[model samples]
Target chain A: MNNQLLPERTVYLVSDGTGITVETFSNAVLSQFDQVRFKEIHLPFICSIEKAKEAVIKINNTANETGYPPIIFSTLVNIDIMNLLKTANCIFIDLFGTFINHIEQAIGHKSNNSIGRSHMVSDSEKYRNRIDAINFSLSHDDGQFVNQLNKADVILIGVSRCGKTPTSLYLAMQYAIKAANFPLTPDDFERNTLPATIVPFKSKLFGLSILPERLSEVRNERRPNSKYATLEQCRYEVSESEKMMRREGISWLSTTTKSIEEISTTVLQEIGLSRTLA
Target chain B: MNNQLLPERTVYLVSDGTGITVETFSNAVLSQFDQVRFKEIHLPFICSIEKAKEAVIKINNTANETGYPPIIFSTLVNIDIMNLLKTANCIFIDLFGTFINHIEQAIGHKSNNSIGRSHMVSDSEKYRNRIDAINFSLSHDDGQFVNQLNKADVILIGVSRCGKTPTSLYLAMQYAIKAANFPLTPDDFERNTLPATIVPFKSKLFGLSILPERLSEVRNERRPNSKYATLEQCRYEVSESEKMMRREGISWLSTTTKSIEEISTTVLQEIGLSRTLA
Candidate 1:
C-alpha cells in the first residue's frame, strides 16, 4: 500500500473551456483515494498564456499554503498554455495530451487542438435540437401548455415539491429530451386519477413520490402552517398519487432520497429514452 | 507500439443510482482516446444481485458479439453485487470500492456503503437550496420577474436564442446558483443602456452575444422569413446588443460557438462565484 496518505491537499481543475470535464474527471479519480481531503479550485477559460501564468501562480500559492504539492488536472489543448501550466509546483495530470497523441497515431492525422472545441456549438443540428428541447420543457412546465402534450418525449407527474421541475429541466438540457412535468395537486388526489390533460399521454407518463414526512418538510419550507404543508395532507397526497399511478399503470419512483439526476435518469429509463450526447 | 487499436468498442456504464457519475467519469477518460468510437450503454439503479446478474449477462453478450472484452465502468457499492459482476467477461473498473476502503481506513470507521448515497437529497438544507435556485431561475427567466432582479446571484443578458436559459438552468441545477436571465431585445439596444429594472444590480449582470449569421440561422429555423428571423435583423440585434453591453461596461461573451457549460462557467468566473458542489 502507498504510504502517502495526507490529511488534506489542494486540487486544481484547469481547463481551456468549462473545466467541467476536468472537474468530473478529477472527482472520480480523487474519490478513489478517500484518505486525503481535497480543497478544489476551478480555473476555467485558461485559453491564453497570461491566464495560464496566473493559474500557475494560484496553484503554486495553494501548494505553498498547504505544505504539499497540489494535484493539477488539466484539459488544455494549446501546447503553449499547457507548457506554461507545467511550470507550476504541482503534479500535473494531462487529460488530453496522451489521448490526443494516441488518437493522432491511430487516425494518422493531426487534431485541430483548438481551445474550447469540446464544448462548442459546432453542430447546428444538435444545437437546434437542444434549444428546441429547452423551449419545449419551459413551455410545458407545470402543465402550462397542455395542447402541446403530444410533442413531449416524457411527462413526469408527482405532488408539489417532489422534484419534478429540476428533473424535467435536467432531462431537457442534458439529453435534449422534451420532458414535461405536471404537479399532482390535492384536486388530482381527491379525484384519484391522473390529470385530464396528461391522460392521453399515459404511455409517456412517469411518477415521482416521496416520503410523507420528507414531503411535508419540503412543503413546509415553501408554505409553513398551511394545509398543503401539513404532514397529514402530505401523507394523504403521497398515498393517493402513488395509488393513482399504480391504477393508471404508470411506473413511479420515490424522490425521498434521490437526487434530481437520479430521478431524471429513472424517468428516462422508464420512458425508454436512450441517453445521447449532444 | 502495441497493435490493439479497434474501430469500435462497447462501453457499459453501470451504477446503483443515476449512472451519471460513472457516465461523466467514463466520458472524460474516453475523450482522451479519441481514435476509438464508443457505443455507450447506460444501466442505472442496479441495486440488487439479480440486476447485477442481468448486467453481467448483457455485458458478456456484448463482449461475445464484439470479439473484444467490453469495458464496464461501475459505481456499485454493494460488495456481493460487485463480486457477481466480476464474473462477467469484461474489463471492470470499480469506481467506489477502493476509495471506500481507503476512506474507511483514514477515517477510522467503516463506510455505510449504501447505494445511491452520492446523489441523494438527504440533507434538507442543501435540497432546499437547490430547489430554491431552480425556482428562482425559472421564475426570473426571459426578464419576466425583473422586480426580483436583486435576488439573482448572476443576471445573464443576451438576445433571443443566445443560450441563456439553458446555461442559467445548468448553473442552478449543478451549483445551486440563483441565476436569472434577461433577453436583450431591440428595445434595450435602442436605448443604448441596461434595462432600468436591472440598472441597480449592474454588478450582477453578464452578457452573451453570438455571431450574427449564426444567430440568423438559429432564428430562421424558428420563424423563417419574418423580421425576427431575417439576417439583417439578427445582425442588427447582435451588434446593438454587444455595443450596449460594452457601453455599460458589462462583461460579454460570444455564445455563437460556445456550449451552455462553457458559457455558464465563464459567467460564474467573471462574477467571481465560487463553484460549490451540492
Candidate 2:
C-alpha cells in the first residue's frame, strides 16, 4: 500500500435525492479499487441547470482546497449543467449521459434526444410476467391486506411461509417498494402452471422457490396438525408446482437458502431494477 | 452465441432466509457448469438440527425425482445440516462452511462457531463500520422529534426535498420502521462536522446529498418565493454542505440521477443490514 507518500484521490457521487443507486454501484465498483482514495457525496434535488453549474463550481473549488483533484460522478437531470462544469479540472461522469449512450448502442438506434437507464432492460420479458402475476395475485389474494399491489414497485413469490410477508414489509418500509408476494400453493400445483392471467405479462415474473421441508416447518408453526404442515403435502405441492413450471418452460429461482440482502439483490437484478437506499 | 440446447444445470443457494444472494452469485458462476439440469431451492430457518435433517431427505428425494444427483449451493445456519446432507449424492457448495474454513485456516485458529452469511459479514470490522454509518445516518438529526429516532429501523438522509418524507412514510406504513428525517441545517455546515453524538456510531452514518437545483425546484413548489427556493441558495448550500462533509471526514453519496430503487439498494448495502425477510 502506498499510504505513506501518495495523495488521496477521491470520487464524488453527486445526486438529486437519496443518492441510493449511484452511491451503491459506485461503492461496489470502488470497493474493487481499494487502493485509491475514492470518496462519495450525495447532493440531492439538483433539478435545475443553475444549481448544477454551481455544484460543478463548488466541486472545482473544493478540489483545490482539499489538495486533491477529485473526480465528479454526477447524476443530474439538467444536461446544460453538465456543460457548465466543462472547465472543472476533474473527471465528470454523467450517469445520465452514459445511460443515453448505452441505450442508443443496445438498441442499435440513435435517437435525436437522450435516453435513461429504464431503457437498459426494456427488453426483459420475464419481468413483465412477474408484474402481471403480482397484480393478479394481489387482486385474487387481497395481498395480505396490502391493498392493490397493482402499484407494487416490487413483488415476492416463494413457497408457503418462506418469509414473503416480512420481506415484503421490509422492502416497503426500507425502500418504499410497493412490495407484494404470493405463495406457491397446491392450487398452483393442480394447475401445474402460473395463473393464466400471468401469461400476458411473463416478462415481469420473478420466482422464489424455497425448500419444501422449510415450508412444512413454517406452516407447521401456524397449523401444526393440518395437511399444510405435513412434509408429504409440502413435497407433493412443491414437486407438482415445479413439474408444471418445467412443462410450461417458465424460468424461476429458488429461495430455499439465502439471506435477505441476497434475495433483495436478486429481485432487483432480475427485474433490472434498483431499490432506494437510506 | 452458442445456445447449445440450453445446458442442463441445477443451481442451488441455501441460506437462512430469502436466498437472493445465492441466486445472484450462482448465476454469476453459471459459466462453470455448462452441462446439467438446473434446479435450486432456497431453504429458510435452518436453525435446528431436526429441521436440517428433514431438509436433507427432501434434497435426496428431489434428486431421485429429477433422475439426476443435484448440484447443491447452500448457506445453512448449522454445521450439522451439512453433515446430514453429506451422504446425499450431490455436489455441495456450502457458503458458510467454505468461508468459515477459510477464516479458520487463515488465522490458524477456529472461528467462534458463527454461522450464516449475515453473521459472516458481521464478523468483519469494515462491514460493521459501513453498516454502522448507514444506521446512524438513518437516525441522526431528527429535529424536534428528539428520541423519536430511537425507534427507527431505518432513516432517510438527503437535501431539503429529496423524497425523504415520502420514503419514510412508505417504510413506516409498509414495513413498520419508525422512519424520521431532518433537513441539513446551516448550523451543521458552520460546524463542518457531524454531531458529536454521531461519533460513537459513525458506522451507521449515511448521507444523502441531492442536486442543488432539484432541491431549489422542490422548495420552490412549496414556498415559491423564499430564499430557500432560490437557485443561488441551493447552489451555495449544496456546495457548503459538501465541503463540510469533506472537512469532517464524512463519506457521503449523491441522490441525483437515480430512481428510488437504486437509492434503496445503495442505502441497504451501505448499512450492511437487512430486516427479517420473513
Candidate DockQ values, in order, are 0.34, 0.05
Lowest lDDT 10-residue stretch of candidate 2 chain B: B28-37
| Model 1 CA lDDT for position B157 | 89
Off by over 4 Å in 1: A1-8, A28-37, A47-51, A76-87, A94-117, B1-7, B32-36, B76-83, B94-117
Superposed model 2: Cα runs more than 4 Å off: A1-9, A15-21, A77-79, A98-162, A169-261, A264-278, B1-149, B153-166, B169-278
lDDT of 1 by residue, A1-278 (tens): 34365566677888887777777655555554445667789988898988998988898888788777777778887899999999988877776674555445433445566766556676668877987898899989988888888999999999888888888888988789999989899888777767788888888999899999998988887898999999999999998998898888889999877778777887777788989755
List model 2 lDDT by residue over A214-233, tens digit each. Answer: 77866775687897789998
Q: Residues B42-131, candidate 2, lDDT per residue (tens digit)?
A: 564466777677777877887787665666766554567667766776667654454444323322344444343342233343433433
Positional deviation of residue A39's Cα in model 1 after best superposition, in angstroms: 1.8
Clashes of each: 0, 97
Best TM-score among the predictions, by candidate number: 1
**Where does candidate 1 clash, by residue pair?**
none
Residue lDDT tens for model 1, B1-278: 23256477788898887787777766655654545677899988899988998999999999889887777778887889889989999777776663455444433545556776657765668877888999999999998887788889999989998888888888998889999999988888777777788888899999999998988888887788889988899889998998888888999999876778878887887899989665
